[model samples]
Target: MDVKEGDVLNYDIVVVGGGPAGSTAARFAAKEGADVLVLEKRQEIGSPVRCAEGVSLSWLEELEIDNIDSSTSRTMKGAILYSPAGNKLKITERLAGDEVGVVLERDRFDKDMARLAVKEGADFMVKTSAVGLIKEDGVVKGVEARYLGKKFEVRADLVIGADGFESQVGRWAGIYDSLKPKDIMTCFQYRLTGVNMDPDFTHFYMGSSAPGGYVWAFPKDENTANVGLGLQFSRLKGEKTPKDYLDEFIENHDDYKDGEAVDMVAGAVAVTHPPEKAIAPGIILVGDASRVVDSMTGGGIVNSLKQGKIAGEFAAEAVREGKFDEEFLQKYEKRWRDELENKLWRNYMAKETAMQLDDITFDKIIDALSNIELETVTIGAILEGVKKKYPELVEEFQNMI
Candidate 1:
């Protein structure tokens, strides 16, 4: 149904933001027979792409997204981690944190998700922005929005806030969505051609240069790739921007310097604690809206997709049972946390520990890991190796793994 000004358009579930999480939630909710609607503020569902687009194959299989091959740009075998001193530590495809998989055309991937939702009977309105929460007697019941240039209202039994990292919906619903400077990664990336590099493995460089985070080179093809860097906000000194560090990194690396820059992208990743409360009466937050991105890796696609699936199904159940209170919406939070919260929290702690280490400690840690020979790299294996060589460095991380 087309929205009109002054109309309180109704849906069983209204999802704000048509990104992966929102679309996935909408799709699943619709599959469960709920009247679902998705509102995307952007004129296009996935324009102005802002991701490196590397995703693990295992999770895609779990999600049963069979058409991923069509959108994949390159197949990655593993990642090569480079320390500040240029020491290389390779985590093979068998490693737990390897992230061996495909680099997607992110815009295509997001559009595909929206298509899935529409196919599942969810109505999506691009150019529709949720400006505020529709609260009925202190309970979130829908959203006050602007479609194109017209003001409108969307009323629903439940509201799923899958908005992006800078989510206003979650804040409007009174969810604690704040992040400290130390917990935010200011990132910048560029697409480059005329690059000479291995097409199989994604590359990561870590140390003070990208303080509290890392620089990445995710390949799109033999001649093209998304080269990027992320630095914790607290680590930034003077007027130095993420771009300044990235430029320095490119200048230092032969491969990056040789490449011709084509396009650039920038964004911030919340590498912080996930909100303890991601639910309110008739409202649920998923994806970055709930800060599900990993603090250590800055990876969120798999986690976001997982949360979206759970949120969608749970939203449907809530609508079915006519239970749109905080008590009922709390299940979505529990299910997603049960699946990912431990890893997310542990990784956040690990990132904090890593941020405190100097370049020499980072070099030692990389050297220690390189000494270990294993078929598959697990957190336990890596930590045990580090403990054997540098027991002092592993002390803070002992409880985390």
Candidate 2:
């Protein structure tokens, strides 16, 4: 059932969710001469963005992405890692480059990605929510989306689900869309005004203070910053919600004692790796939709860029070759999963194991991390430390290693 030219309903690819992944895919696909349409459920491009806004310079280099003109808030030589006892480990950022990763204005960055996509001929339909998959004989052939209050059908040879953590496309495409309890981290963030935070290296504090996760303050300016806390959802059963923990943190910390919040954002970051299957007949998933975000850092910019490029190229290739079968379109999955799946899954496993430890274990673990060569710290080393000092902690973590 090849679509002939002149069908207003037809396109080479239809991408759902116009975030980083969607836009990236659309950009590259359109660059490669495919007809691409991007659907965004939101009215604005980067409003309500949920991110810590930190990315390694290596990420930019790896993707060969040029940095757009943006103001420099701060430059860091490295990160300052803190222990429960308030011990500090100053790790250098040389691994990335002479310059550590910059805390980007994520909204502007997103708009740039979208702009590039649009310039590459990606059409956009904001306020458009994809309602269901348009299936033709069990083969995914496009989608049914709601725009402004009307239903529309779009037919394409390939469909990409770049939707966020709560992705419906993956579920509709027959993939396991449910997140494991251990694979989700709850986050609460604020843009605090009047806080005197050092606009240098990002700070990472760990302990029962933020059990199963950490707290960070990414300086947006001298008097304002994006400060946030994250704790694995499982860690909050008998403890505070992420928002409550953040309040406690701000109340206790001297720098933010009287900080006034200018903005607040709450969300979840998927710690899971890419789904086992990245594609089905005529369909693919990328970014949070594919669970490609980092479990530890909760960062998705780099991974999203990689996944988007792969999806776009592969979608065009699949459509051109007329190989809409799952086997043929599964290359994107293989590429992304190969590049990051191991790291993401391993981090998730270690996080789950680490989350079970009580306060004392966490304190001791931090102490070990504090004195060790922090820059090269690996999960295996931590696991060994737990086994040696707190032998009882080994049982819960043996499966993880």
Q: Please report the candidate that would top TM-score against the real structure.
A: 1
lDDT per residue for candidate 2 within 1-401, as digits (tens), equals 22222333678899999888999999989988899999888987777768778776665555546764462345556677666666665656653344366777777777878898988888888888888988877888898877777777788888899988888888898776678766788899998889876667677777766767889888777777788987877667865688889999889888876889988989998776557787878888888888888776788877888888888888778867888887777677787777778877877766656666666666676565555553344566556755666666677767654
TM-score of each candidate structure, all chains considered together: 0.96, 0.88
Q: Global lDDT of each model?
A: 0.86, 0.77
Q: CA shift at 166, candidate 1, in angstroms?
A: 0.7
lDDT of candidate 2 at residue 274, scale 0 to 100: 57
User: Per model, how many backbone clashes are there?
Assistant: 0, 0
TM-score of 2: 0.88
